[model samples]
Target: MSDPHATSPEDVDLSRFDAIVDVRPQAQTRPHLPESTFTPLERLLEDPAASLPSTSARVLVVCDIGMRSAIAARELAELGYQSVTSLDGGIDAWRRHGLPLAGTDSLTPNELERFDRQIKIPDIGSTGQSKLRSASVTVIGAGGLGSPVISYLAGAGIGTLRIVDPDVVELSNLQRQPIYALSDLGRPKVAAAADSVAATTTQTATEIVQGSFDSSSAADLIEGSTVVVDATDSFQARYDLSDATRKAEVPLVTGAVYRWEGQITTLVPNGACYRCIFPSPPESAARLDCALVGAVGPVVGTIGTLQATEVIRISAGLAPAYAGRLLMYDGAVGTFSSVSVQARPDCVCQRP
Candidate 1:
């Protein structure tokens, strides 16, 4: 029999449910079933901190074989629930018992059409889409890397974009930066990028700051921006962004792409600042700009895409997340690796 007491992970405290399903019948079933929605241990660990059915939760655990379900139920015992029981015959039993599956009729007509794609995803539905639409992001450059960053940020429905770049477009930028066309050759990077936002995603308001973004400008931008994407290529620019965003305690999604190499790192206040990672400028600086060197189209695309993903996730309230971690990508080999970030004890602390 299904228990009347069902506790979800969102229910912070137990004492919510009155009945719990017994999983004795689950043990007799097979290990796996074709139609089961039950999540495997590996899948659960992949999203580490996602709330699951707590053993103390009064949830009616469904399993193909009640045996495994009961076993999994015990995993939530320490969560302070009173029950983590399973169905008598699992989902099969629930079916035989004539329990009705929830219907989609609860959705409004427009909602059903608007969120058709999101509704299909398990965790992200209308709720997540709304969160995404209301997200605010700040892009710390409107040049090469920022081009893709701004385009995708707008396409993603970021409610607002604050672009910080003091440069203008030039003929040399045509090779890699496509956000600006030849007609926009002389326009400031921020102005041209803002125009792109209006043309594509009018819903996202673009604010262009014509001045350079130093420690002071960074503070104002970080104040209301939920996420900051560092598309700046220069080491000095990256360091300034790191120090300033860290001081403002904003999450910084920093990315840089050269010929075929790219790197991304997400930083918060206590995160390892770029200063901590690249403690001092290289003995001899590598002033390699595509104008001087060259770059592949997809290289910046891949890196900027990663930065966009991090920003969306930060705005979406995800946890067990990326902070103080550097992710490096090599488009040539198509390999990606990551390492943890740490504070530099020898470095001077700079505030926003």
Candidate 2:
């Protein structure tokens, strides 16, 4: 006789169950059935009440090859789960039956584990994680602002990072640009940034563009990129990147720091561009370089971290936080403020 407590993949109708539970090991449980809850068999066996919903709910348990799920179903039934069933062949059979799975199939079991905590977020679940795994971001500079931006993005599992910089690491850069060490002094910033990203996560691929980001090179550097980050120190480079990304219809996250103050914003195609805010570069006397006036390391780090978050949000298909506004931070007072901004009618960004 066949087991009444088990159902085959052909008989499964996901809508009928209040909860579909995966009882496989955590590492093997990703890319599971859509909207399925993951409660490893070990955890479920130890405490069914804590691991799952009410026992009266219609539940379906699945595993790798069906054995564990079958055992779990029987145990749950004995524990007074009114309606529970196991997948007769588990995920293996579901796969054979050509059913849909959620995460990216390209991710290995190890990659799943490495990103387990991030993948657990409801908003950034396996689907969002997959998007991140396929995203490519082009960072315009590898200095203070780029340091935290690159580090955090790599940690967040961004698929590809293209770092562009024309300068070499100097002793003064070590204050805010943590991606390099003393030994790296005099080495190209792009190369050092690539090595830093590699150390953070092997899953991310790094492309080092050892050149400046200007109108001539901006198009090619940001081609095929999901987003472009403006971590440049000069207003000229920022304006160039903003125009390039706007023309290409790609999103751009731009940030700046001076002394203990910093600001960041995101610009999307057809929306407000950088010129909408500044209109033109500040006069040479007004423009302050960190090297000339000095900057607080944490101030740049703070702005860079926020810029990275914006990049991740855009890459994962979420709304940009600072799309048409500027977020400013005052490290001296430990306060943050935001100002609304709009597209300039007379600026090139508004031209057809």
| Index of the highest-lDDT prediction | 2
Candidate no. 2 TM-score? 0.76
- Candidate 1's C-alpha runs over 4 A off are 1-119, 350-352
Model 2 C-alpha lDDT per residue in residues 1-352, reported as the tens digit of each score: 6788999999999999999888876623256777788888889988988867898989999987789999999999998998999989887788678787665556666766788787766567667788898999999899999999999999999999999999999999999988899989999999888988887788899999898888998889999999999998888788888888999999999998989899999998967998888886767524447878889999999999999999999988789999889999999999999998899899887777
User: Relative to the true structure, how large is the alpha-carbon lDDT of every model?
Assistant: 0.64, 0.87
Model 1 lDDT on a 0 to 1 scale: 0.64
Clashes (N, CA, C under 3 Å) per candidate: 11, 0
Compare the candidates by TM-score and give the number of the best one: 2
Cα lDDT, model 2, residue 203: 89
**Ten contiguous residues with the weakest lDDT in model 1:** 26-35
Report how far off residue 96 is in candidate 1 (Å): 30
RMSD to truth, every model: 10.0, 7.5
